[model samples]
Target: MTRPAAPSQFDDPWQAQVFALTVALSDAGHFPWTDWAQAFGATLKRHGANRALDGGADYFNAWLETLESLLEQRGLAGQAEARTIRAAWEQAYLSTPHGQPVKLPA
Candidate 1:
């Protein structure tokens, strides 16, 4: 018997972006993949994630949390930098016109 495939598509676009960012950062050697895997696993365990239901298994947020935690722990980037970047994106998203894509401020 074959195991079920993991769901690749996320319910939200930001979740997808967060998932991609983790892979890109790992590929670029910002952090070792093993470390990332550990971080992600630790986060899932902390959150008591139930991997069966779609809503229950919203792991993208966990992925983002893991990445942020590693950045803080490893000093690749700190919490302040993460906060600033996240805030900028939030502002850009709020400022964007309806039905238009968000763009970062110049």
Candidate 2:
């Protein structure tokens, strides 16, 4: 499958995380885009519009942060696990293909 472009430093990390989570989950048949979009919109409202990212990279980063927080809160992962996940994401981000939809490692 085609992968999306890598996010730039100017991009929000949380958004990128959430976007990646959404993509990964959807790819796994766990949730749909509409549901993810609705939840994302609500998250933005609750978290504040300023937290709502503008660019692809920024959005992905925001999403990633959200995912880590949620995972921690849900007791699915610990700080170490989150750190590992973040590191892996960083590596993937650096190596990801530009202008295509790439799958995040599960």
Candidate 3:
């Protein structure tokens, strides 16, 4: 039997945002799609997520890692900056009141 189509919904907005950013950055020529595929595949393998176990859960996590790796490899963003950005997101998510949008620090 044919497999069912994968759902488009993400577990959270952050996952969706990561997915969007991957596409946007790739489109902007940070890396070609072939490079993207290799990075993403390596990330998935590293996470032992090559198989669609747990219903393909953690796919976006790998995507985020791949995005970061690509950005770092392409000299677009430093590792320190990535860590800072992650911390800023965590703080924004924690401090924002429920129902309010999280904002990056200016």
Number of the top candidate by TM-score?
3
| lDDT of the candidates, in the order given | 0.78, 0.61, 0.80
Greater lDDT among 2 and 3 belongs to 3
- Over 56-97, each residue of candidate 2 has an lDDT whose tens digit, in order, gives 554554455555555565575677876887788787887888
Q: Could you give candidate 3's per-residue lDDT for residues 44-75 as a string of tens digits?
A: 77787445534234888778777877888789
Q: Give the TM-score (vs. native) of candidate 3.
A: 0.72
Kindly report which residue pairs in candidate 3 clash with one another. Answer: none
What is the model-wide C-alpha lDDT for candidate 3?
Answer: 0.80
Ranking by lDDT, best first? 3, 1, 2
Give the residue spans of candidate 3 off by over 4 A.
1-8, 49-52, 93-101
Q: What is the C-alpha RMSD of each candidate to the true structure, in Å?
A: 4.1, 10.0, 3.2
Name model 2 segments beyond 4 Å from true.
1-21, 49-53, 56-58, 69-80, 84-106
Instruction: Estimate the TM-score of every prediction.
Output: 0.69, 0.39, 0.72
Candidate 1: global Cα-lDDT? 0.78
